[model samples]
Target: AQSVTQLDSQVPVFEEAPVELRCNYSSSVSVYLFWYVQYPNQGLQLLLKYLSGSTLVKGINGFEAEFNKSQTSFHLRKPSVHISDTAEYFCAVRAFYNTDKLIFGTGTRLQVFP
Candidate 1:
């Protein structure tokens, strides 16, 4: 089965601070990379994806990530994060041919303290 690893479980930062969430994956073949953000009790929303072409991908809410083939990693980054950006971020991966489900990492919680 495909697997993903989230380096950090929690990250605390002040409002308007910069944040980064590291993610790595292990797959036998090519895969799709995705970042999902979950705010409080709400469901997850697609932040960004690296499907094909270009190593860098940009997502909603002023967030972005870079796909590194050599490292098998997709790291999320935001230059400046607001209080609203505080949420649980998850790194996920899907096999190129498998449409059944997505493999997700443990997750990283970004707490923006005011």
Candidate 2:
């Protein structure tokens, strides 16, 4: 069975501070990695993805992560965060095949303070 785990259910930080959201996955086969962010009362937007190459992947909004094959982990990080960055972040994995379904982690709520 394929599964994803988000270590932290929530993370709070002051504005303009650094932040990291941990994510781990367990899959029998190879999968595509993705990080999506959802604001309050809104849909999720794609943050980034690790498809085939490059261990380190950079995303929008000054966020980035490195895919650790040995550890089966992908952790998101940002040097400095803003209050507007407050939202729910989800890590997901999709099969390499044409399956549209994605297995997602529980999700991590990031609260950016002023």
Candidate 3:
């Protein structure tokens, strides 16, 4: 089984500023990681994923993440955040054996101010 931890519960940033939401995972076995974002009154939407190959993965809304095996971390970053970017973000891990189950971090609230 794998577990995910979102280092920050909340991150506030000014509009157009760069932002990073830290996430770390613990697992002896290999795992697939994902980042999802939820806007106000909306369900979680896929932001990016790290299955294999590339260490740097880009996703929707100009968000990107780097997979660091050495640090066991997959942190999400956006160079220029917008006020509309204010939302809740989650980090999830899926162990290869348990394809149907995903262990998710508590979540991080990104508050983008104008």
Candidate 4:
């Protein structure tokens, strides 16, 4: 079985500060990593993903993540953040070929302060 673990449950940052949300996972099969952001009262939006080919993957809103197979980690980083970035971030994973089923971590709440 595979599982995801987000290193942080809540992250508070000043506007324009850099942030990194840590995610680690363990699996027996090849997997795809994902980061999704959920705005207040809204649904989960795909932020970035690490499927294949590239070790580094970029996503929307200047967010990027690196895939480390040996370390078994995919951490999300942003050079700068805005108040509007405040939202719940989730780290997820799925079997390499399975797209419909996703195993999500206990989300990290990003609270950007002005």
lDDT agreement with native, every candidate: 0.94, 0.93, 0.95, 0.95
Deviation in angstroms for 48 in model 2?
A: 0.3
Q: Taking the tens digit of each residue's C-alpha lDDT, what string does model 4 give over 1-114?
A: 789999899999999999999999999999999999999999999999888989999999999999999999999999999999999999999989776889999999999999
Ten-residue stretch with the least lDDT total in model 2: 93-102
Among these predictions, the greatest TM-score belongs to 3
Q: lDDT of model 4 at residue 3?
A: 97
Candidate 1 vs candidate 4, lDDT winner? 4
| Model 4, C-alpha of 42: deviation from truth (Å) | 0.6
Q: How far is candidate 4 from the true structure (C-alpha RMSD, Å)?
A: 0.9
What are the per-residue Cα lDDT tens digits for candidate 3 across 1-114? 689999999999999999999999999999899999999999999999999999999999999999999999999999999999999999999986776988899999999998
TM-score of 4: 0.96
Q: Which of 2 and 4 is the better model by TM-score?
A: 4
Local error of candidate 3 at residue 84 (angstroms): 0.7
Q: State the local distance difference test value for candidate 3.
A: 0.95
Ranking by TM-score: 3, 1, 4, 2
Which tens-of-lDDT digit does each residue in 53-101 have in candidate 2? 9999999999999999789999999999998899999999887784788
Per-residue lDDT, model 2, residue 53, is 92
Tell me how far the alpha carbon of residue 88 in candidate 2 is from the true structure, in angstroms, after superposition.
0.2
TM-score for all models, in order of appearance: 0.96, 0.95, 0.97, 0.96
Model 3 has a clash total of: 0
lDDT of 1 by residue, 35-112 (tens): 999999999999999999989998898899999999999999999989899899999999999997999999999999
Q: Which regions of candidate 2 are displaced past 4 Å? A: none
Give lDDT: candidate 3, residue 51: 92
